[model samples]
Target: MKAKELMDKEFVYLNCDDNVVEVSKVMEEIRRFTCPVVNDNKQLVGWITSFDITKGLREGNEKIKEIMSSYEEITTIHEDAPARLAVVLTANNKFVTVPVINDDNQVIGMIRSCDIVELLSELYDIKVYKLYEAMQHQLKGVTWEELMSASALVSKKTTGVKISPEDYEANIMNATFGEAIWATGGLEKFFAGLISVGEMVIARKVGKARR
Candidate 1:
C-alpha cells in the first residue's frame, strides 16, 4: 500500500500569522491534536500541535511561528513511499499523526497512527472489538489465557452492552499484530464462556477471510 492511499486530505492547517486563539478554535472544532503551518508563499514552514498552542497561550501573545515545530526537523514521506515506511516512522517517532508532502514540498495530506493500524487490521482479517480489549491487557503483560478470563468477567458484568460492527471493525483494523492476537484471544474466550459455544468458530472464519 502507498501513503497516498491512506492519507487524510481534509486536514486542518494553520498559517504563520494565525494567532493562538484561531488555532485553538480550529483544533477544538476539528478535535485534532495538530495542524500544519504554512507561510504566506503557501510553503510548508512548520506544524502547530495542541501542546504548542497551549504553551503559546500561557506565554501570552507568542506567535504561531514561535511555538510551531520547524518543517526541516519534521519527518516527511512522499505519496509513493511504501506503507511500511509510514508504519516505521510512526512507531519510531511515537507520532499520532504525520504530514505528507508532495515533490514541491507542498503539504498534500496527513496520516494518523489509527489509520495505519486500521489498514493492517483489515489486511489481517482480525476482529476490532476483541483486539482493543486484548491490547489493554497485552500492554500490561497479561498472558493470553489470563486476558481471556478477564474478558469473560467483563462481559458477564455488562450483559446488555452492545458493540456495533463498525466499531468492532475499526478496533480490529487499528490494532497492531500482537495486539490483535491478544484481543482475539481475549474476546473469543469471553464470548465462548459467557455468550455462545460457537464464538471461536466465527472468529476463525473471519480470520480466514481477512487473509
Candidate 2:
C-alpha cells in the first residue's frame, strides 16, 4: 500500500506565522501531538508538536518559526512511497504523524501512526481492541512510556549491547506489543507476557469470527 492511499488529506496544520498559542489549540482540538507546518505558498516548511509548544513557552518564543522544527529537520515522504515507510519514519523520529509531499514538496496529506497500525490490524486479521486490552492488563502500573524505557534494558539483556535511551523512547511509542517484543528479541518477561495474553485474545476472536 502506498502513502497516498493511507494518508488523510483533510488534516490540520500550522503556518510559519502561527504562534505557540495557536499550536496548542490545534493540538487540543485535533487530539494530536504533532502537526505539519507550512509556508505562505502552502509548501511543507516544518512541523510543530506539543513538545515544541512546551519548549517555546519556556523560551518565550512567540512565533511559529521560533518553535517549529524547520524543513531540514522534519522528514517527509512522497505520496507514492510504501505506507509502511510512515511507520518506520514515525518510529525513528518518535513522531505521531509524517507529512506526505508532492513532487514540488508541497504538503498534500498526513500519515499518522494510528493509520498504519489500523491497516496492519486489518491486514493481519487481528483484533485491535483485544490486543490493546492485553497490553493494558500487562502494563497496569507502568505507563507505556516507562515500559518503553525499560525495553532498552531488555534489549541490552538479550543482545548484550545497550540501546540508546533516546532511541528506545523514540521508537517504542510507535511500536505495537509484538513490535516491541521483536525489538527486544523476545527476552523481556513483560513483553512476553503481554504477547501471550494478546495471542490468546486473538485466538478467541478468531474462533468467534468462525462461529
Candidate 3:
C-alpha cells in the first residue's frame, strides 16, 4: 500500500494560529494526541500534540506555532510514497501519524498508526486489539489510564528493567513488567505485572483508533 491509499482524507486538523486551548479540545474530541497544523492557505505548516500543549501551557504560549513541530522539524510523505515510509518515519521520530501531501505540498490526508496497525493485521492475518479492549474483563471498571498510571510508577524507582514499546506490545500479557504492575498495588492491572512509564505512553498511543 502507498501513503495515498492508507491516508485518511477526512481527518481533523488545526490552524497554525489557533488558540492553544483549542488544540486541547480538538485532541479530546478526536481522541488523539496529535493534529496536523496548516496555514490559512491550507498548506501543511507543522504539527501539534498534547505534549506541546502541556509545554505551551507551562510557558504561557498562546499560539500553536509557538509549540508545534514546524515543517522543518517534521517529515511529510508524498501522497504516492510507499506506506512503509510512514512506518519508518513514525518509528524514527515518535510521530503518531504522517501527513500526506500532493505535488503542491498541500496537506491532503494522514497516515495514522492505527491505519498501519489495521493493515498489518490484514496482511498477516493476525489478531490485534487495543490493550484497553483486550483488558476489558480484567479492568473490572478501572480505567486503563488509571491502572496504567498506577503500574507506570514502578519504573521510577526500579533499577534496570526497561521494556520498549515493541517488546511490551508483543509480550504485554506475558512480560515480566506484569510483576512490577502488581507491585504498584493496582487492583485491576493487566497481567498483574509492572512496566515502564515510557511504555504507558506507548500504551496510550496504541489505544487510539482512526475512527
Candidate 4:
C-alpha cells in the first residue's frame, strides 16, 4: 500500500486569510476537527484545527496564521511512500491526519489514522484487532459512539463471535476511569502471553474484547 491509496483526496482546507470564525464554521460544516491551510498558489501553508479556532476566539482577534500549525513543521509523506512508513509516522507524531504532498510540495491529500488502521487490517488479516490494541489505552472518557464503533469493527472482523449490546455495555463499564487501568493491565498481560505462544489471532480477539 502507498500513501496515495490511503489518503483522503477530498479533505477540508482553508486559506491563510480565513478568520477564526470562518474556520470554525467550516469545521462545523465539514464535521472535521482540522483543515489544511493553503496559499494562493495552492501550496501547503499551515493547519487550522478546532483547538486553534477555540483558542483564537478566547483570545480574540488572533490571526489564523498565528494559531495554525505551520506546514513547514508538519510531517508530510510523499504519494509513493510505503504505507508502513505512514503508520510509523502517525504513531510517532500523535496526529490523526498527516498531509501527503506531491513532488512540488503541493498538498494532495491526507492519510488519516482510520485509513492506516484499515490498511493494517488488510495487510495483516487481523480484522480490527490492531485498532483495538491502539485504541484500548485511550478509551478513558471516550464517547459511547466511539466504543460502539470499536465493537462494530470487531464484529466485522471476527467470525462466530457476535458483539452483543450487553458486551458493549460491559466494555464501556470496564473502560471507566475507575476500572480502565486494571482492565488495560489484564489486556497487556494477555498480549504478552499471546506473543510468547504465537497466537496472534487470539491476541487480536482478546484485545478487541477488552477494547
Candidate 5:
C-alpha cells in the first residue's frame, strides 16, 4: 500500500497568511489536532497544531507563518511512498497526522495514526474460532431489529456474503479475517456478516423452542 492509498483526501490546510481564528474553525470542522501550512505556490512551508494556536493567542492573533512550526520540524511523505512510512513517521515523531505530498510538494492528503491502527488491527489478528465462540456466547439474545439493520447494511453496501444467512453462519464461522474479507468484499462487510449470521442462528433456535 502507498501513502496516498491510506491517506485522507479530506483534510485541512492553511495558507501562510491565515490567522489563528480561521485556523481554529477549520481544525474544529475537520476534528484534527494539526494541519499543514502552504505558500502561494501551494508548496508546504510549515505546519501548525492546537498548541501553536494556544501559544499564538498569548502573543495575540498572529499570521500562521509566525506561529507555525518550521518546515524542517515537520515531516512529510510522498504519496507514492510505502504506507508503513506514515506509521513509522508518526510513531517516531509522536505525530497524530502526517502530510502526504505529490512530486510538486503540494499537499494531497493527511495520513492519520488512527487509520493505520485500524488497518493493522484488521490485518494482523486471525483468531476466527475465538471470535465465533465469543459471538455465540455473547450474542445469544441479540434482537431481530439489530439483525435486520445488519442485513440492510450488507444489502446497501453490496459487500457481504451473498449466501443465505444460515449458510453464512455455518460455513464462514471460522473464516480468517482476510478470508472473510475476500468472501464478503471489503473491511466493512465483516461486521454485517457477523450480525446476519448470528441472526439466522438465533432465529432457528427460537423457532425450534416454540415447536
Candidate 6:
C-alpha cells in the first residue's frame, strides 16, 4: 500500500508557534499524544508528543518551537511513497508514530505502528487461531484482552463460542482498543461491529445452554 492509503488523512497537527496549552488542546481533541509539527507554510517541520508538552511546560518553555523536535531531528514519508517506508520510520522510533507529507513538504497525515498491525491483520485474515497460539505460549502476566486482540484478526465466523462476563471484560474491551484493531478504517464505524461481536458472544452462550 502507498503511504497515503495507510496514513490517517483526518489527522490533527501542530504549528511551531503553538503553545503548550494549544498542544494540549490538540491532543485532547484528537485523543492522541503525538502530532506532526508544521511551519507557517504548513510544511512538515518536526513532531511533538505529550512528553514534549509537559517538559516544555515544566521548563517554562511554553512555545512549541522551543520544544518540538526540530526538522532535522525528525523524519517524514512522502504520500506517494510505499507504505513500508513509514513502517521503517515507525519501527525505528520504537514503533511510535510517523508523519506523511505531500510533494510540497506539507504534512498530510499520520501513521501509528498500531495502524500497520491492523493492516497486517486485515491482509493476512488472522483469526481465532492466534488466540490458541498465545495460550500455547503460556503467556503470563499478560491480560487476556491484550492476548486476544493481538491474536484475533478479521474473521466472519465467531464459531458459536460464548464468552462469559469475565471473558468479555478481559478480551472484549481491548478488542475495542488501539482503535478496534480487529476491524480496519478506525473508530467511527467500529461501534456497530463491536455491538455485533458482543451479540455473537452472547448468542453463543445462549446456544450452549440450550444444548
- lDDT for each residue of candidate 1 in 18-65, tens digit (9 for 90 to 100): 888878888999989988887665568898888998888888864788
TM-score of each: 0.59, 0.57, 0.56, 0.57, 0.60, 0.57
RMSD of each: 12.6, 14.8, 17.2, 13.9, 13.2, 14.3
Q: After superposition, how far is residue 157 of candidate 6 from its true place, in Å?
A: 29
- Best candidate, lDDT: 5
Q: 3 or 5, which is superior by TM-score?
A: 5
Error of 5 at 186 (Å): 26
State model 2's lDDT: 0.72
**Is 1 or 2 the stronger prediction by TM-score?**
1
Model 3: CA > 4 A from native: 126-211
How well does candidate 3 match the true structure in TM-score terms? 0.56
* Tens digit per residue, CA lDDT, model 2, 72-129: 9888899999987888888888777889999988899988888877886664443333
Q: Name the regions of candidate 2 deviating beyond 4 angstroms.
A: 126-211
- What tens-digit string does per-residue lDDT give for candidate 3 at 21-43? 87787788878777889877788
Q: Write the per-residue lDDT of candidate 4 for residues 1-211, one digit (tens) a residue.
A: 7888889998876887777887787789877887788888768889877888898999885468878988767788898998778889999877888888888878899888987877665533433334444454444444445545545454444434567645655555444332432443655653443243234344545677799
Q: What local distance difference test score does each model get?
A: 0.70, 0.72, 0.69, 0.68, 0.77, 0.68
Q: Which tens-of-lDDT digit does each residue in 100-175 have in candidate 5?
A: 9999999999899998888888764575545666765686665444454444445445644364545444543456
Candidate 3 Cα RMSD (Å): 17.2
In model 5, what is the error at residue 7, expressed in angstroms? Answer: 0.3
lDDT of 4: 0.68
Better of 2 and 5 by lDDT: 5
